[model samples]
Target chain A: DTAVSQTPKYLVTQMGNDKSIKCEQNLGHDTMYWYKQDSKKFLKIMFSYNNKELIINETVPNRFSPKSPDKAHLNLHINSLELGDSAVYFCASSQDLRNYGYTFGSGTRLTVV
Target chain B: TQLLEQSPQFLSIQEGENLTVYCNSSSVFSSLQWYRQEPGEGPVLLVTVVTGGEVKKLKRLTFQFGDARKDSSLHITAAQPGDTGLYLCAGDVTGQGGKLIFGQGTELSVKP
Candidate 1:
């Protein structure tokens, strides 16, 4: 069984459109995170949720929002997507990450035309 | 703000060769982790080193955390084609809860 899974492995949308990516972890971890990997393969943290509480919000664009319905699920919603928003989005979960490594899901590749 | 800098962003080597990739940062980290990501897939944790100057070995691979806890290195002995992937180094900021700052990543290509 997959410890973490994300839907819509590939997405292509026209510019100015909105899209959403869903993620869920079955590991029962208390924390979830969203990261974006740019064309240069540089990974950056966008948001971090612990027990469905917002925490560690990086200086990401306001158009990008993260919603954690619960500790097991964290979804990302993008509004007025732009070409620069096209990147691989990854979901990860961990318990007390300072003492552990995160378990990541297969990434969702977003393409904005 | 914290940042991790990875060296030798791209490395291509023969199957039997040995290589080392470095991740450096000026900020101290509570722990360091190494992850390997394949094409179109998420990264899988290879190892995590918490103590400074700690060394851990997994099969043909070895990881070392600098004494200052601001740098780390991954060394592979006799790399194989299957080892070709993107290697990422992430650090856990001392004050950032459950936050990991990642490096730019090192793309390694091992040819048989």
Candidate 2:
């Protein structure tokens, strides 16, 4: 089975629209993270959850919210998305928060028009 | 501030050519990892180097971590067209649990 999976591989929506991206990890990892890859190919961490508890919340705008129902799932919800929000969103999981490599999902490409 | 800075942001070379990518940081790290990302896919972990001055080899690819744990390098030998992708270096600073940082990444294009 795929280790980590993100739904809606591609998304295109009008500006100001709201959407949610779903992510699931079957690797039984303790920490799950959400990352945003920009047009410049820069990867930035947006949020991190360890066993359903929010740990790292970067300086992202309040429009983006992340919810973790359990240790295996972490979802990202964007409210009134803006044009600058168009980018690829990736979901990742790691057994440890400190020194281990992460397993990342295929990613969801969000395009705002 | 970008804690980790990667050099040679873009590299285009012919098949069978060798290349090296570098990741530098001022802050010390507990562990550093190398990942390769292709279009429409997430970055895949290629190797992890934790010890300072440690070197690891995976076939034609070689990874080295600085002795001070503040820098790292990836060397690919006789690269093939299939090796074209975005190479990223990420690290976890000492005692910072949630502060893992990723370099800007190097876009590698190996022409046939």
Candidate 3:
């Protein structure tokens, strides 16, 4: 059984197109996060939500926004997607903000042409 | 920004070789974790070291948390082809939440 899952394992779209990546956690975690992995394999935190409330938002561009419809789901929506946005986006969830390890999804690889 | 410095961004060795990957930080962390990610897949947690100077072993892998909690290392023995993947180290800075500050990552390739 998958603890966390994300939709569209691979996404390809044209530059300036709008797209979204959906994530869900079956572990009933209260905190969810989005991380972007660049071509260099550098992983950077983008956003975090605690109990459906925005908590940590890094210096990411406004074009990248994260929405948590519920405690179990966090979605990443990009407006006017650019070629630089092409990277692997990962979704993770934790029981709480209490230092517990996170459970991550398989990841969604987006390619903006 | 709290940064973790990972050395030897790329590693290539033959099977049966031994290697060590490091993650260093100027800022001390409450806890740290290591993960292994394959192509087209997300990262899978390998282990978490909380106490300073703690060491843990899993099969052919060994992990060490620096006495100052500012660095960590992963040593793999008898590297296998299955070990080929991206290794990432993430630090739990405040120890209160899942706010993970990750290193650039080390890509290891094991030749058969």
Candidate 4:
């Protein structure tokens, strides 16, 4: 079974359109994170949730919002996406907030035109 | 801002050749981790080094953490085609609220 799975492996949308990416983890981890990888392959943390509580919120734009309905699911919703939103997004989970045994999903490739 | 600087943004090597990748930072870290990412998949953890001056080996890959806990290195011996991927180093900065600061990453291409 896939430990961490992300829906819509690939997404293509137009500018000003809104989209959402879903992430779920079966690892029973307490902490989950959303990271964005740019064209240069630089990974940056966008948001993090620990047991359904917002823990880390980076300097991302207001258009990006993360919602965690439960401890095992964390979803990212982008409002009025722009061309610069084109990149790969990854979902990851760890047993604790300290980043022990971190596991990442395959990732979703978002292309905003 | 706490940042981990990875050197040699790109590396190409022939099979059986050995190479080393370095990750450095001025800020101290509580722990450090190494991850390898392929073409389409997310990164997979290779190893994690916590204590200062700690060294761990997995098969032909050896990882070392600096004594100051501010830097780390990854050494691969007898490189293979399967070793081709982007190597990333992340550190847990003190008082950052559990956020892992990542390095720029090193892309390795091993030709057989």
Instruction: For residues B1-112, write the lDDT of model 4, one tens digit per residue.
Output: 8889998899999999999999999999989999999999999999989999999999999999999999999999999999999999999876655678899999999999
For candidate 3, the per-residue lDDT at B1 reads: 71
**Clashing residue pairs for model 1:** none
The digit string of per-residue lDDT tens for model 1 on A30-112 reads: 99999999999888889999899998889888999899988999999999999999899999998855537999999999999
DockQ each candidate and list the results. 0.80, 0.72, 0.67, 0.74
Specify the poorest-scoring 10-residue window by lDDT in model 4 chain A. A93-102
Full-model lDDT for every candidate: 0.93, 0.93, 0.92, 0.93
Interface RMSD of 3: 1.6
Provide the TM-score of chain B versus the true chain B for each model in turn.
0.98, 0.95, 0.97, 0.97
> How many angstroms is residue A75 displaced in model 4 relative to the true structure, after the best TM-score fit?
0.2
Candidate 3: CAPRI quality band: medium
TM-score of each: 0.97, 0.97, 0.95, 0.98
lDDT (Cα, tens digit) per residue for candidate 2, span A1-113:
99999999999999999999999999889999999999998999998898899888888999999999999999999999899999999999989677579899999999999
Q: Write the per-residue lDDT of candidate 3 for residues B5-108, one digit (tens) a residue.
A: 99879999999999999999999998899999988888999998999999999999999999999999999999999999999999996843468999989999
Off by over 4 Å in 4: none
Per-residue lDDT of candidate 1, residues B8-55 (tens digit): 999999999999999999999999999999999999999999999999
Give candidate 3 regions above 4 Å deviation: B95-97
Give candidate 1's error at residue B13 in angstroms.
0.8
* Residue A34, candidate 4: alpha-carbon lDDT: 93
**Over all chains combined, what TM-score does candidate 3 have?**
0.95
Residue B97 lDDT in candidate 1: 65
Q: Which ten residues in a row have the lowest lDDT in candidate 4 chain B?
A: B92-101
